[model samples]
Target: MDKKKVSSWLESELKGYTLKSSQDDFVNFLIKQADKIDKEDHLLLKDLAIDWINSEQKDLTTWGMTIAVEYNIQEATPSIEKLLGKVKEGKLWTLYYLWYIDGFLKRIKEKKE
Candidate 1:
């Protein structure tokens, strides 16, 4: 698939979008659709993913992590780590976020190999 086309579609799809499904369901839809696109679109998707992850909404942040993991956006590690640090101690949400970041880092390593 064309990177430009995919990026444009993502931009429009995510605009003013609200979470209406479970996090996993939403993430699955995004990753499955993104998988149809070429890996060369990583830069565009990475930007979108990072932006989403940085959003104030918890759902958006989760979606962002999913996109980052799916696309192997290693460049997002530092930001992910920073967010992890801010998670309140002993919160269950930290574990969930950690799982995503760990998977994302693993994919990055695999890509490097």
Candidate 2:
């Protein structure tokens, strides 16, 4: 691999993405970034999946779950299911917010898809 070119390209294309001054620093940074991203991806996917399971007015939650699961977001299912139980117990505004965000996200997904 053209490490220098890849490094330069990454630095140019991604904000805050830069090769460290030292090789050890760069290796450590990459490891730390990968770990951080894994954690963040877990959390975001969890929220999105919960938003799906808690949804009402349509099977939007199911659709959301389908999408998340397709992308291997397993961590989200439990949270989503928990929130769904709460929403089903008559937490009105929670359902509304879920639906609203679902609509917004659906539009975004449609455009991307």
Candidate 3:
């Protein structure tokens, strides 16, 4: 994570990736990024998640939910149910995004303990 501008590149990718962009390219890339993040990176992802959860685009919303689940981002808590409803109403495959919503709340509850 220390390749100077490399983080920006990652941020750019995360920010700009679209569902049509290589078909699941963002999800595929996030699979690698999911565990490598530290506090600063988590914070960055949190900020991104805020907007992503609010996004109308299912791909962005799902990716935001993925980051929220992986990182336990509390800030995203408020939007979880609402975002789930939106994604569920979208294309069927986007329903795959709903998978992580289960763990997200469970982990948040655990964190409170």
Best by TM-score: 1
Q: How far in Å is the alpha carbon of 76 misplaced in model 1? A: 0.8
Query: After superposition on all CA atoms, what RMSD does each candidate show versus the true structure?
Result: 5.5, 14.6, 6.6
Q: Rank the candidates by TM-score, best first.
A: 1, 3, 2
Q: Rate the local accuracy (lDDT) of all candidates.
A: 0.63, 0.47, 0.64
Which lDDT tens digits does candidate 3 get at residues 37-113? 54447665577766776765665666766777666687787787666666678843367767766566566556656
Q: Report lDDT (Cα) of residue 42, candidate 3.
A: 61
Model 2 misplaced stretches (Cα beyond 4 Å): 1-46, 79-113
lDDT for 37 (candidate 1):
51
Error at 74, model 1, angstroms: 0.3
Q: List the residue pairs that clash in candidate 2.
A: 50-80, 52-61
- List pairs with backbone clashes in candidate 1: none
Error of 3 at 47 (Å): 1.1
Error of 1 at 60 (Å): 1.3
